[model samples]
Target: MKINNKDEYIIIVGCGRLGSHLASLLSKERKSVVVIDNNEKSFNRLSKNFSGFTIEADAIEEETLLKAKIDKADVIVTTTNDDNTNVMVAQIAKSIYKVPKVIARLFDPSRQEIYEELDIDTICPTILSAIEFKNIIIEAGGED
Candidate 1:
């Protein structure tokens, strides 16, 4: 689903690199955003100009999801470093809270099929990086 509307409510789980970047971008575009993370310091990744709300709590916890008001979220993104945690958060947002759109970041490409089976959208950096590196090698005349 597209997030062209600036008035949409976006919830991002994990305030790490990806999560913070998304929060900043959405916030800049005037979307209502809430970022959740277990470590308070992780929020530091967010830009100083970010105007979104932040909650220091484990996103895998149901209470934390409730506190973030997931029920009202138009989109939920899970970008924690751990694949399992990201999957759990994405599942909770999509399955339990019934968030309209749920996206997750997974480092392990092997587990992507599992999430896809559950109907959750995923972005796998590992796979993307491999593709980019393969392209670079091919450009350099390296054999496949």
Candidate 2:
């Protein structure tokens, strides 16, 4: 659990579409990253695409976080499909270990406000999806 001062360490939980994309982009920026995903197969997509540490485990567990060196992390980003798990992991990382920054992915748009109120930055994929949907509808509608 060593954090190198030269680069900020970022922990990304979940290796699904969003997580994988974010991890790849961050790794491209040359940031030290440790990604945790329960499904071993989830990491397959990330293997060649990402140049960072990958851990196959639950991010909700403190021990898992410790193993990933959450205590030393500059930021913890929970991007799992499960909102509860992401929120819980964010809370633990923020409240317990007191990480300077915690970002939790919100699958449900309904919870975005609440997460923000709690001082956890939430990235709602639904919002982005809706915007994309709107653009597609507008483009197709114009052709008709």
Candidate 3:
């Protein structure tokens, strides 16, 4: 389902750089956002202007997912540093709760195929950085 309206709910797992950034952007747009992280200190990354539900708990746990109301979420984005943890949470969101959209951030590019097989959308910064670096080099004609 398309979240064109502000009332649509978006759940973000992990409050690190990527997760916090996404939550801040979505919150600024007035979208209903819920951010989960194991460490409460991690929530400090969020901007003071952000007005979204912050849950301090391990997202890999089913209980945390329940508290976050994963079932009613229109979209779930897992940005944990661990590829395995991201995969597990993504699968639960997609297969069990059947969230309409599930996105994950994976650091390892090799695991892209695994996430693809599970029909989970993934953003790999490593791969993106590599591609961007290559493009810059090509455009610079390999000049110093």
Q: Pick the candidate with the highest TM-score.
A: 3
Off by over 4 Å in 1: 139-144
- Per residue, candidate 2 scores C-alpha lDDT tens digits across 1-144 of 233455489999999988888788888878988999999899877747578999998877778999999889998889888999999999999889999888888888887888799898888877988999999999999999
**What TM-score quantifies how close candidate 1 is to the native fold?**
0.90
TM-score of each: 0.90, 0.84, 0.91
What is the lDDT, from 0 to 100, of the residue 47 in candidate 2? 44
Better of 1 and 2 by lDDT: 1
The reply for model 3, stretches above 4 Å from the true place, is: 1-7, 142-144
In candidate 3, how many Å is residue 138 off? Answer: 1.2
What is the C-alpha lDDT profile of model 1 across 54-136, one tens digit per residue?
Answer: 99998878898999998998899888889899999899888888988899999888888988999999999888899999999
Cα lDDT tens digits for candidate 3, 1-144: 234674489999999999999899999998999999999999999999899999999888899999999999999989988888988999999999999889888998888987788899988998899999999989899675
For lDDT, candidate 1 versus 3, the one ahead is: 3
C-alpha positional error of residue 66 in candidate 3 after TM-score superposition, expressed in Å: 1.0
lDDT of 3: 0.91
